[model samples]
Target chain A: MDRVGTVGIVGVGLIGATIGLALRQRAVAGQVVGVDIDAQAIAAAREIGALDAGGSDLDALRPADLVVVAVPPDDVVSTAVQAAAVMKRGSILTDVASTKAEIVRALDERLAGRVRYIGGHPMAGSEGRGARMADPALLSGRPFLLTPTDRTDPAAVSMMTEVAERLGMLPVLLSPDDHDDLVAQVSHLPYLMAVAVVGAATDRAIGIGGPAFAGLGRIARGPVELWVQICRSNRAAIRRSLGQFRRELDRLERALEGEEPLEILLQRSRRRAPVDGVPLDKPPR
Target chain B: MDRVGTVGIVGVGLIGATIGLALRQRAVAGQVVGVDIDAQAIAAAREIGALDAGGSDLDALRPADLVVVAVPPDDVVSTAVQAAAVMKRGSILTDVASTKAEIVRALDERLAGRVRYIGGHPMAGSEGRGARMADPALLSGRPFLLTPTDRTDPAAVSMMTEVAERLGMLPVLLSPDDHDDLVAQVSHLPYLMAVAVVGAATDRAIGIGGPAFAGLGRIARGPVELWVQICRSNRAAIRRSLGQFRRELDRLERALEGEEPLEILLQRSRRRAPVDGVPLDKPPR
Candidate 1:
């Protein structure tokens, strides 16, 4: 694969730092420059060799072949718009945000043809966040979903695909709406359910204990402010997903209240099993 | 700790095999006799060194100094009753069941003073079940809740505590009802919620294109039969927990339905942070 030229990364947090580490390990021929509003984060990125040079100044990204916007979901649009203003003409741009449709729409409406922008979300993370916790192997063996709008340049998409390949990620292409809905069902909904359960049990009447609590409360540990932004930004899709979840809860309630045979409950629950997977245990004789 | 003599394991299955292994590894000076109705399981126990002698005969437990009943909730009563009939005059009996109230009630009514039965639940397990998955270190550093009825013998409780200490666990004393409620809130209800969400997603559409799908689908990989049994046995408590969970869901729904500020939703979710004993990160500066 051809080496990438100077690459600029905005928001040197967990995702940005990880991308920088991945770039270095993969030896992508690029002078990776990181830019973060937080001076401490910028300093940390430099200390960890995650950036050749980075600062709050937009001029730091002026000479890059590609620019990656790795801010929170709420900041994706404003950051992308600002970065686009200072970007070299025809420079390709991409973002690692959870929601896609909104960013795609924002870029399409506000920065048409000034620079190519493609939306991408890597389905990976740890409970911990920030550059300090960044791992080079975080994206390895994970799926990276790319949502390229009709107006997106093919070469831009191709370039980002090369970067994803260099990071050892399997890139899958989907539309913006499709990506949003998929994440709502799989990621956003589960997170909401986890938060709700943990909230309900926070009272003194219940004591939290065991691996089950940790497993169920795993996503509840996510940054509340970030989640609020995510929930707000993706409200429509999240509400739709929550509606589906509510219906399922009602079904379970009915089954329990009606004293439906155990077999019926088992059948309904068994549908949750992966279609192609065997039971967690080997078959009992 | 003094070496246990003639250990009796009732309803020999996964937990029984694991206890046997732990005892053997510690070189407890005793013969491990396993009792189970399933002849195949008894054979497997002997083959795996989980038992020195095995049979369907409850009478075989007569000489045991310590009797551990590892059985399903529904079978706990009948098995305890049968084992109590032939238990050694001064032996200590303990049961490792998920719910404690029902078993404690059963033992109180049936055993009387024939033998001492203390209810114990080790908060440890993998997604798998059966003797094949048994591990000696399963209880290491795990909390073992012991729920002893008022009528329970002090000597018996002491013996069970010693057993837990020997196995390297922290024994926590709680009332049977409290134990039931704790597990219902943390373990049983969460499993049900996970299964419900997984089922709901699978019913609608399967977008299994990322690690998020696999992460959310993990609990769904658990055995349906085992979960069905657990849900049915702990129906009353789980129902109450689910009701509380539903109210939280309703609150979230109301928040979403209203034009209320996003801060309300975020506040409710943030309340769960302190209960988890971790300081939540502040929203991005």
Candidate 2:
């Protein structure tokens, strides 16, 4: 946003609205235009001053110098394509999708030369959803993963990094492959495993859900529709992550069944202890 | 403890010291004797007002109306056997061990007709250890599982229930099998999976441990020695629980592989939402 005059935001949901709010609060965007399929989300985004103007149409993204596609993974590629077409010829498009590899591939195939694209993932979110849950400082001091393929414009990536920094985020560069692989194990699989843990509970145990079980299973309570799409989009990576979990669990199980000591596994896990700055230690509700 | 004059707490660590402090604060026992292999723990117990008197000798448990075995699960039966033999014949002996089936079985064989034994477990704790982390209200308004077979004295069970109530607990009656099954799935399996989740994390993901992964993996960071004993002692139940987890996770993975909707699983897991009583949400330092 250093030299960019206008910014366009598509799909003004939680992440979308938060980015809009943070950018507006920092005056990073001279004019912000918000677009959403949900009229209420667009209206709410405008009500919170997250945008200077809002519309319930894709055409609203036309006037911006830069466009940010803040949609769910399933919608990210399509939204990126739409925003890329609507934006000015030289304008860049980026996405805030959890899974970057698929979106980056799609962008490379569709809009490689016509328009530049960078994949972004702000490694922060809550179990909560909607524009109502938006906050201006939600991205403050958080890591924003900038995943760029060989096809991505270098200048666009640098400008996006500057914008990320201006909005109070630490922009860390990663390949689409590395980003997806890391998040699958750290984020996606953790969410699915939470579901498995809760689902594995007996009826009586469900009725008597203790702290450990409840806390571990909290992320399973997030939006099912969105996660279903995420799971579908990143099926291979998530499955691989789950497989890793099973293998480790199987090894521990073997040790346990054979009455062998659990010292090694226990020691390995101790590294994830109550360390400060670890979001996992203080997960959002 | 209505008629009981003195209470003996063997292994004066977090749980033991918390029980001692709660009993003393409620005036449930005229005197609370703390016994531990660790001399510093006994000294800390006395210093923190969790103990009315403290000693490191096994004979310290002999002069009490109720001798409470508060050792690790692996040592629960052995400690109870020692405490049962040392205490007065008519005096009741209860344990604060997590696994009830094994300890209850041990009591039926060893103390039957010779000394009354009630299997007790307070279903509340933090990750922190030692008397320094003890809280008088640790068990307040939390579930306390009581496993008593037909051979257990009715009066001893009733008195133990009263004592649990005095310490601000809701005494829930569960058979050894029910207790073990419930805790295996609800408590033990969750902890083991936390270890597995952390263990499965790649070096990069571990370095980027987000809130979801860290929060889900929090229990993995707890003391290893105690968990090794808990894992070994409850091997059968925990293994079965891990199997249940594996099956559920496999089903989810299959669903993902098949590109099937996860609405039902996600909805089911939402039941484990944020609850105030859960200590996993607020783990000790």
Candidate 3:
């Protein structure tokens, strides 16, 4: 039930504009302001009624009680630091980057006591890009991961939790490193698999490909630059996940050659990736 | 425009039942009969109006002008041979199996010149299984691949093309070997990738996994026994595709490690995958 008086959103891209729309439409914020380097993006977001006021100035974030930096993954830490410089004392600063460990550590070291810094990653997105494709309901019913270190203010985390609920998201709290590790296994690894599939299948295979191939290759069409940064930011965890994937791939190859049991491997995979049943993974404590 | 006087469908499972529904609903056949080893499957197909007549005897196929064998991949050749035995001379025999080369070769040697056999692979399916989940609309607007060799009759191919069109499918003609090769790369390889992803992520990462992971893992939840047969049937092509996949995966790993330029690889992948654009792959000749 706790609503922020004013919210400032940096980068007015898909996630940023979506959050702005959700906050404004759900009455979670008294005023929603957006700041973007691109004036056209700011105008596009404001035209969609996602922002009460928005401009291409850091000054626009000054009156806000909370600031959400929703830039590209590589720019997250820098944008948060810049937003923090303009944000008033006692205001909370957070980000919507896909990776969290590096960002959280940098922000904690730079602006720990000066301003409340919390890291966030809302696990929701559309294949479509930009503020024009932004939807208020995109955040609803999705897991909103909050990566808060020991140095992060508890009040900031609580406020973000309330905001996530107001936007109809299931807020999940975890340490920054844990967030990075888990997402590497689930999100980043799957994305890389798509990329590899697209690369391997090439034009020849894609021509005759069916719905299954299309479904598997869906995320391969995502923005490359953003994904590159995400991979770079979470290199160690992604590498570990890729190693696991290689071993699994080897098992599948061995099964195909009749050296291993195919049915058992497939049955185990089916259990791990349930189609309709409740997931088997343990929830974060 | 060419309609079969009587259509016999063996194996009233998902694909078979769906084909029956399409034929019956679209008025593509004068009479539709189904025969399955499981009496319950025949009843379920009948309940859904997928068949006008169905039983557990091969004698039901004696009057059929066209017999479609829609059993598991491993059973496809055997069922087709069995169906051919009861089918009157000059009757066309086809199948709706995922793999075509082995079955086509086996049938050509066993029933060549005796019965008209054209191999078929409908590029459509749902995650849900059995006759109860069958949909008439499942075959509509999907690619229905027909594999015919020099021994295949032209009239049989034409009749099958008409049937595909009547069911609202895009009929594509290819050699049995080509059909197996393409599907191995597109369908079978993607399925393996999903299996590998599930095996790698396991239950530990699935708890916080989002839509991307779910999308990539969708086919991993498919029937294991069926997939095992599919893999066994198209082992050579699938192994080749896996090799290509491993090389691509190596490139991705190198990209992640800053050993390769990531953006170029991603841009090429985006072009190949083609989320909303006309796919870069050449259409079947």
The number of the candidate with the highest DockQ is 3
User: Per-residue lDDT tens digits of candidate 1, residues A212-283?
Assistant: 566655666677777777777787888888887777777777766655554565455555554332223322
Please give the CA lDDT of all the candidate structures: 0.76, 0.80, 0.86
Relative to the unseen true structure, what is the C-alpha lDDT of residue B89 in candidate 3, on a scale of 0 to 100? Answer: 93
When sorted by lDDT, best at the front, the candidate numbers are 3, 2, 1
Pairwise DockQ winner, candidates 2 and 3? 3
Task: Tell me model 2's lDDT, rounded to 2 decimals.
Answer: 0.80
Q: Which has the higher lDDT value, candidate number 1 or candidate number 3? A: 3
* Model 2 chain B lowest lDDT segment of ten: B276-285
Clashes of each: 0, 6, 0
Q: Residues A116-225, candidate 3, lDDT per residue (tens digit)?
A: 98999998998878999999777867889999887888889999999988899989998998899889988999888888887887565677668778886678878888
**What proportion of the real contacts between chains A and B does each prediction keep?**
0.35, 0.63, 0.72
Docking class of 2: acceptable
lDDT for A51 in candidate 2 is 91
Q: lDDT tens digits, residues B1-285, model 3? A: 656789999999999999999998888999899999899999999999999999999999999999999999888877888889989998899999899888999998988867899999888888889999999777777788999999999978999998998899889999998888888878899899988887887464687778788786677878888998999989998998899989999998898889999888887777688442236454224
| Residue range B1-285, candidate 1, lDDT tens digits | 688888989876788888887877776737889998899888887887888898999999988988889988778888888888798876788888888887798788778868877889988777657777778777787777899878889987887788788888778888888888778887777777766676566432344334334544566555666666677667788888998888878777666665566556556555544334232443222
Which candidate leads in TM-score?
Answer: 3
Evaluate residue B283 in candidate 3 and report its C-alpha lDDT on the 0 to 100 scale.
29
Model 1 lDDT on a 0 to 1 scale: 0.76
True contacts kept of 2: 0.63
Model 2 regions more than 4 Å off:
A1-5, A25-32, A46-49, A58-63, A113-115, A136-141, A259-261, A272-285, B1-4, B25-30, B58-63, B113-115, B136-140, B259-261, B271-285
Q: Which candidate leads the pack in lDDT?
A: 3
